[model samples]
Target chain A: MTGPTRPAEAVITGAGLAVAGYAGIADLLGPVPADRDGDPLAGLSRRLGRHKDRATRLALLAGGRALADAGRPADDTPVDTGPEAFDRPGGRTGVVASSNYGNLDTVCGTVDAIDAHTYTGASPMLLPSTASNVVASWIAITYGMRGANLTLCNGATSGLDAVHWACHLVRAGRVDSVLVAGVEPGNDAVTGLAGAPAFDGAAAIVVESARVAAGRGAPVRARVGRYARRADLRDAVAAVAPGPVDLWCEPEDGAAEPPVPARHRLEVGAQLGRRSGALGVLQVAAAVAWFGRHPRSRALATCGRGGEASADAAAALVLAAPEDRS
Target chain B: MPGGIAGRGALASTGRTAEDMFAALCAGRSGVDTPRAFDLTRYRTRHAFEIDDRPPGGGDVPMRATGWLLDAIGAALADAELAPDLGDVPVLIGTTLRELRSAELAWRQHTDFDTDRLHFGHALRERFGATTTYTVTNACAASLYVLGLGLDLIESGAAETVVVAGVDTISESTFGLLDRCYPAPPEALRPFDRHRQGMLQGEGAAAVVLRGTGDARHGLLRAVAVNCDAYHPSAPDVAGIAAAIREGQSRAGAKPSDVDLVFLHGTGTELNDQAEALAMAEVFGDTPPLATAIKCMTGHTAGASGLHSLIAGTDCIRTGAVPAITTLQRPMDEAAGLRLVRDTVSGADIDLVQVHSFGFGGLNAVALLERGR
Candidate 1:
C-alpha cells in the first residue's frame, strides 16, 4: 500500500469560541476568571432562538461570530440584495459540527414525554431535536448555508475529525468555505451520563481555500498543515510533525504523552474543564490565538481516547502561522 | 475518479446477507410486522420492520445496533477477501440514532448504562482492531454521505481501502414522534402510492467495502453529491433534491438518459414522496428512468436505508434483476410521467443506477453507480 499524499492545504480565516469564562479565541491566552457570567446568546433574537436546544444556540452564536469575523455578511441576508451578498453565497458555505452529548437532554425529555403521555402527548416542537444532527442543521438553517452539511457524533476524536473533514471539503473544492463547530452542553442529562460536568459551550473556525481567502481579502490566521490518524500516537505525531513545534495542545485524557518535542505544551481540558466533543476544536482555536501572539511558529493539536485498550486511533494535526507556510 | 465497490453486506428484517436481502426484495417479501422491541400499545402505528434474531447478552456491547453493525462489517470484509483485522483502514458508520435507544432503555428501566457505549469506536476497535472510526449522524442520508466521503478518501489517496456502513435501531422516541406526526397508521408502507399515509421505522445495518485499486466485483461508485436545503428542518425541498441529482449526474459525466435505474428515497410519507417525485421530474423531464422503492418491503430502515438501496442496486447491476414496489396499488399523480416498477423485471440492461436518500433537516444525498467491468 502507498502512503496517503498530503491533502491540499486550506487556511483558517476566523475563529469564534463561547466556552465558560472565555468569550472568544483571544481570551484563551489569559487566565479565565471563575465568576465570569456573560451570556453566549446575547445577540440572538428570541424568534430565531425559539425551540432551539442549548447546543444549537451555542453553535449559532459561535457560527455567526466566525462568519462576521471572516468579514463575510450574515448568511441570513437576501441573496438578491446586492453584489456583496454574492461574496459569501449561502449555497457555497457549508457547516460541519461535532457534539457527542449535545442533544441528550432533548432525547431524554422526549422519551420521558412519550413514556408518560404516549405519542399523542409528545411535543411537536421537540420532534426535530430528536435527531442528532439538529445542531448542524440549525446552523445551516440560520446561516442559509446550502452546502454539504454534516454532523459528527464520533467518539472522543469527533471535534478534530470535524476539523479534518471541514478542511477536506474545502480542499476537495466541494465548498468554498466551511464553518466547523464543536459544542457540548453541561446539562443535568449530560452530567449524569458523563459522571461529571461537561463543557457548556462551543468553538468554531472558518476554513477556506487559500485562493478563496486571497480573493476575499480575508486575513489568514493559520494554514492547515499536515494531519494524520494512526493506531499509535507516536505514528500520528511522526506523520504530522517531523520537527519540533512551538506549542502542542495535548489531549486531556490521553494516557501517554506525545513523543514529539515541543517548546510548550497546553492542555485544553485543564483550563476549560472536562470536554468530550469540544476539545479538538478548542485546541485549533487556541493554536490560532497563539499564532497571533507569536508569528512564524507552528503548533500541533492531538486528540483521541489514547491508552485505553478499546480506544480507536489517535489523531494529530499541525498548524502553522501564515508567514511560516512556504 | 470512481472507487471500486469491492464488497457489500446487509442485515435487515427481510434477510441477513446482502444476497439474501436482494433475493427477498425480488420476491416481494415484506418485513413489516408488529413492534416487538418496545411497547407500542398507545401508538397508532404498532408495526415496524425489526430483525428477529437477537444478539445474545454478555460483553461490553451497548445496543443491538452495534451487534448488527459488527455483523455487517464482518460479512463485508469476508466478501472482500480482506483480513478480519482492518488494521489501519478507516471505518465510517452513519446513523440517525447511535445508541439513544440504549439510553432510553436505561432511563426507563433504571438500569446501569455506560455512557461510553453511546459511541461505537471502542467496540469497533476491540472487535475488528479498526483504529480509525467515524460515527456520522447525518440523519437518513447519513450512509450515502459517508459513502461519498469514502470515495473522497480513496480518490485523495488517503487510504487504499475504506469501509462505509450505516446502522440504526428503532428509537422509541423517534417512533413516537412519527406516530404523532401521521394522522393514521396505514396497513403497510406504500411508497409512491396515491394513498400513501406515512413511513414506518425499521431497524437494520448495511456496509460496503470501497477500494481504490482492486477488482470491483459488485459495482463502481461513479459519483455522489450532497446538499442541504437550509429551507426547512423536516420538510424536503424540491430544489435541493433536484440540485443533488443534477450535480451527481454531472460529476459522473452522465446524463439523465444514461441512468438505467433510480432507487427512490420513497419513504411512503406524503410530503417526502411528493417532493422526491417532483425533484425526479425536474431532473429527468418528461421521461424518468425506471424507479423502485425498497422501503415498501423493508419498511424504511432510517439511516441504513440509503445503503440498503445501494446494496440492492449493486445486486441489480450484477444479476440484471430489478425488484418492483409490490405494495403500489396506484401510482401518485406527482410521478405521472416516470416509470414506477410494479412487477419484477428480469434480464434488464441496468448498467448505471442512481440511489437517493433524504433525511430530516432537509439533507439530500444522491449517488450514482456503474456496472463493474
Candidate 2:
C-alpha cells in the first residue's frame, strides 16, 4: 500500500481577493480611479467591452491583482482575431477558475427578458456570458495566459477543486504556473435558489511550481500537500493528524459539524455570508495569511456536499507553512 | 495516455445506444422534431431533438435530462461489467444546462428548494452508490473536459476506474437563445456545407467508462487535451484550435496522416464552419483524413456533444465504417482538398480517430482514440 505523497511544495507567490467589506476589490487594490459606476476596473471595462456583468467584473478584478502581485504583466487585452495576436511568452501559465452557481443571474435575466417581452428581445450578449467558462477565457486573454484553461462549476467544492487541479498540473510539470481562482456573485437569485445566503466575492492564488518560484526568486508563503477524496469526510479526517487546524467546512445541511479546536478556524460562511464557490478560497487566503507569521502551522480546508454516503462530492486539502514538513 | 476507454454508451436524438446512433448516422435519419416536452410558445423556433422521455429505471415517467443520464450510464456500466455498487469509482458528469424545471416548480409551488437533494450528483450517488462525483459545466465542450480530468485522475493514481459522462436537455432557454442568435435554419442543419445556415440545438446524454491503459481493457485513450483560444467569448480562435489539435496529436504519438478519421466540431454556424475549416487546414494541410460532421443528423447535444462524438469515433474504429455527413451538399473553399464523407463507407481500415469539441469562449478540446484490442 502507498503512503501519502511526500509533501510536494508550491508557494503562494502572489494573491488577490474580493471581499464584501470592500465594495469592490479593484477599489481596494487600485491607484487607478474607479469608473463612473464607482468600481475600480483598472480601466479594463472599456477594453473588455462595456456592460461587463458583475461576475465578469469581479473575476477580472481579482485575476488582474493576482497577476500583478506575482510580478507578471497584467494589463493586456484581446485585440485581434488572428492567432499571432495572442502569442505571448507566459504561454505556459494556465487558469483554473471555479464557480458553483455560475452566472445563473444572467440566465435568470435572459428568462426574465423572455417573460418581459419576446424571445427575440433577449440581449444577444447576455446568452454567451451565462456560461461560466466565458469569465475564464477573458481572464486568459486579459493576462495573455496561453496555457490550458478550465472552468470548474462543481457546486460547493468548485474553488478547492480548481486549486487541487492547479497543484496537480504544476506538480506534474504540465505547466510552470497557474492562476487558480474561485468566484461567486452576491445576488438574491443565487441565495434564493441555493437556499444559502452566499455573498459576493472572489479569491485567487498564484501557485507556481517550486522550480518556477526558485527561478524567479519568489518567497514561499506555504506548501500544499496531497489531497484525499471520499464521499464521507470520516475516512479523510482519520488520515490527517488530529490537532488544532484552520478549517473551512461546508457540511451538508443537517450533518453534525466537525470539530476544529484551532482558534484560527475561519467562520467561512459567517465571514463570506454563505458564499458557495468562494468560501474555500476565502479560508485558504485567511489561512495563508495566518501561517505567514506562525510559519509552523497547518490548515485543513474541506469543500464538498454533505457527510452522507449519498453526498457524492467530498474533497479535503492540506495546506501549511513551509517549515511544517521539517 | 494512461486513460483507456473501457466501455461506452450514448442517448442522442438520432439513436439510443452508440451502435444505434452510428447506424442512424449512416442511414441519414434525424431525431429532430417539434418541441412538445415544454412550453416554447414564446420562442420562434418550434423544433428540437427531444428524447422520448422514457429512460431506463425511470419507469414510464418523464425523466427529462435525468432520464437520459441514467439511461446512458446504465448502458456504460453494463458494458464495462460493473455491478450496481460501482466500487468507489468517481462519476464525473458534464452538463451545460441544469433542469430549471424544478427550480421553476419550486418558485411556483412556494416550497424551499433543497439544492442538495435535487442536484444530479446526489441522485447518481444515491442510485449508483458512487463515492466521488463531479458535475462539470464548462459549456459546450464539458464532456471531453470531464473525460480529460478523468484521464488525469487515473494517470495520477487517484482512481482505478472512472465513469465520465455528459448530458444536457432541450429546454425553453436553449431554443429561445438559438432563435434570437440565428433566427433561420434551412431545414436540416447542414454542417460544413457551403449553403449551411445555422445550427439546430439538440439534447440527450452519453457516457464512457475509463480505466488506466496499463490494464489494456479497451481502446487506448491516446490523448485528451484542452486549450483556450482566449480570443473571443462566443467565437473560437482558429489558431488556438489548430494548436490544441496538433498538440493532442503529438501527445498521442500519432501524425496527421496516421489519423484515419476526424469528427469535427462542425457547429454549422457560418463563422464556426469557416473557422473550423481554417483550423483544420492549419493542422492537416491538403490531405486531411476523412471528415464527418454528424451534427446534421444528431443536432448539437450541447455539453453531451463531445461524448457523442467520442462514442461515434469509437464505433468507426470498431466497425471500420466511416459514418456519412448526411446533410452536406456543398463543401467550402477551405475544405477544397480534403475528403468529406457524405455516405457511409465500410471496410475503411481505420485505426486512430481524432475528435474535436470547441465550446463557447474559446474552450477547445481534442481527444484521440484508438481501436480497442
Best by DockQ: 1
Q: Which 10 residues in a row give candidate 2 chain A its minimum summed lDDT?
A: A24-33
- Weakest ten-residue segment in model 2 chain B by summed lDDT: B54-63
Q: Give lDDT: candidate 2, residue B262.
A: 91
Candidate 1 residue spans exceeding 4 A from truth: A1-8, A75-88, A254-258, A269-271, B55-62
Clashing pairs in 1: none
In candidate 2, position A184 carries an lDDT of 81
Task: Give the Å error, residue A113, model 2.
Answer: 1.3
For model 2, how does the per-residue alpha-carbon lDDT over B241-295 read when each residue is reduced to its tens digit? 8878887887787889999899998878888888888888888887789888878
Clashes of 1: 0
lDDT of 2 by residue, A137-246 (tens): 77777777777777776666667777877887676545678887788887766777775656676777888888778887877767886565566665555445445665
Q: What is the TM-score of each predicted model, taking all chains together?
A: 0.95, 0.90
How far off is residue B169 in model 2, in Å? 1.2
Q: Residue B224 deviation, candidate 2, in Å?
A: 1.2
